[model samples]
Target: MAVGGGLSCIKYLMFAFNFLFWLAGTGVLAVALWLRFDKRTEGLFQASDAPSTFLTGVYILIVAGALMMVVGFLGCCGAIKESPCLLGLFFIFLLIIFAAEVAAGIWGLSNKDKIVQDVKQFYTQTYNNYLQTKQPALKETLRLIQFGLQCCGTTGTIFDGAADTCPKKEGLDAFITTSCPAAIDEMFDSKMHIIGGVGIGIGVIMIFGMIFSMMLCCAVKKGRNII
Candidate 1:
């Protein structure tokens, strides 16, 4: 089989893309596992009465990560072997993943306010519980939220009770800083554009994968050397 210059380049690109996809899958899986085992959050998972919002999201990510790995494997093998069957399968899985992503984006957009409110409520509850109990688990959890968000307590004012455990500040910022609730709002408001951009970028890459897979499949079917 004599593969042409153009097709050979595309084949290599396909392999590269699939390799990166595999790495991304690995990263997602690692993050999911971390969240599953992290001491501060693991306690929440152990309790039966614990809220399911964050739990559900972690499970979804684990499944998605695994699925991406499988799809990526198929794509890589198909490209390397020039197998029409494998490439077709890869295309099908990519299409399904793309559809799922689109559906998720739509759902997230439709329930933006609700999701933000729920998260804020969860933070508020955690903060209040910490103020009353002074438990280690709650303190660690509070620290995670504060440091991760770079925000103080729910009130955003220096007078907030949980401010002591929040992210450290210097001078004026030590007293005047954004609140956790405000940070959450920014996540759904101004910061949401960054998330949307990432989504679009991923979607574009997936489109390229699907396109290249089909193209390679056709090029191989026509007896063009792809290897």
Candidate 2:
């Protein structure tokens, strides 16, 4: 009965892995759609013509999809080898990651509101602080903001074409003289990297689980004289 139960458990885990594999596939598709449509029309999204929130939502989905894929692979091995020890370990690791992802998702959902408010506040503060006293500088700053916003919503080429917006007047020439590069680095420097790192670490754990389960299966089969 113990052997039969272990085998059943392994079968269920393999199915679970298959489900997660499909889930990750869908996530990648969603990201592709966002890159194609939403990214190029940030201003439209802000005006509610299109859903811009997907940009952030898709990022979360990508991370979750990766985690599911790793966990599913580990589960598959555990089921194939009929090793309760491996499946049990895989479940424990999955639970830890699942908890963390849920927490992060919750925080992200809440933070979306906070981010919009904060950006608005920053813009207001900058206008009040710099608009009057530095009228010449203020115009330059607005130009920088416009360029930055455009580049942020578009391609990296926006930064290269910045000289086209130049030919400044009086003190404004100093503004053109100053360089305001778009924050292209933010894409990779996101906090998502930490989650991805953890997922990779968990993948290593799955590798060990697969090896151990295979050896255990081999040993049991040999001792029982069973194929």
Candidate 3:
């Protein structure tokens, strides 16, 4: 009786966890879509010379969200049915995702400096092109960024050859002289902690899901053995 009760509790817990996991997956999908289509980020994608790195990251988020939804459904059904096969499959899926997340976290942390340098290079090159060609899209992007960040060029100085976005007229209260590179860095850096916190939170939730799935799988196996 005690064993049955314990197993019942676990099953319900697993169901609850899977439901939350599914919601998290949906949230990820929503955020990814927003990033892809948001007006603020449109310029990043519209620029003729935009880097594939950013685009690839967005795509990965979309794929991960989709996979999460699939796995979450599988887990919920497996727990409810107490099916060993489904539970085992769920375990495998989660293990793969956990491993991949760990690997990505390690790689990103180790290459932080390189990533920053690459982004800076991309921005500088793109800005130079905007200056020379004055493409409408790039121009609008620059204006948006400058106005949003209250920044000017890469160095935020007229010496870098100010665009119309840069404040040329003196005594303008809305003017900003800080360079875009520094502004960009500050903008992104401020969010790093929030990003890190969310990543860790998701990782912890995944770990719990793995543990629940494995436990339920064992419970199911034991029940079969007794029969």
Candidate 4:
């Protein structure tokens, strides 16, 4: 009976962790879908603009959300089972994700200026290449690329609540369908399947870890009661 009680406590912890992971995962999926649909249908890419900072933010969120879900699920299982193995596995995965997030955030913040400059340089070089080739079709494609980039930055600012200096031209929506909609559509689309794939893999490991951890903990509790 004492052993069972300890195991029950472990189960409660697992359930809590699982709930949090699911909530965070759902949030990520919703935002990714919104970005893909909201902007793509509005001709946000026909004007030869750059990709927006919001898109970058979206990508960052996706990656972080995925890691969080993985770790959270593992933690839930570890706590419920009272198993040392599950607990250790959860801890290890969490540590890895925490370190990665820190590194990526730091690097991105530190190299913001450099990244901006590099993107500008690459944009120029690509345009010049199209010019030399003298391909009308390629030139048109380049125009779309430029528009995507511009919009990426401008949209980011607009969303940030800065003064809206960006031009909102009429027929822009029609132009997207007429000019090229697919290109823009792909930009915001999140690879949920990919995220799911990752989730599945991590989930398997988490399950085993949790089981081991919970069992170990319960056993310890029982032993203490006996003593």
- Top candidate on TM-score is 3
Per-residue lDDT tens digits for candidate 2, residues 85-194, read: 76567657666655665576567556655544443344334334443455554435434444444332122222333333333434534333322222323432353454
In model 2, what are the clashing residue pairs, if there are any?
none
* Model 4 alpha-carbon drift over 4 Å, by segment: 1-14, 25-67, 147-227
User: Model 1 residue 183 lDDT?
Assistant: 81
State every prediction's TM-score relative to the real structure: 0.72, 0.40, 0.84, 0.47
Worst 10 residues of 1 by lDDT: 40-49
Give the lowest summed-lDDT range of ten residues in model 3.
167-176
Sort by lDDT, top down from the best = 1, 3, 4, 2
Worst 10 residues of 2 by lDDT: 152-161
Each model's lDDT: 0.76, 0.46, 0.73, 0.49
lDDT of 1 by residue, 60-109 (tens): 76887788888898889989988889989999999998898788778768
In terms of lDDT, model 4 sits at 0.49
Clash statistics: count for each candidate = 0, 0, 1, 32
Ranking by TM-score: 3, 1, 4, 2
Cα displacement (Å) at residue 49, model 2: 26
Error of 3 at 183 (Å): 1.7
Evaluate residue 55 in candidate 4 and report its C-alpha lDDT on the 0 to 100 scale: 45
User: Under the 3 Å rule for N, CA and C atoms, how many clashes does model 4 have?
Assistant: 32
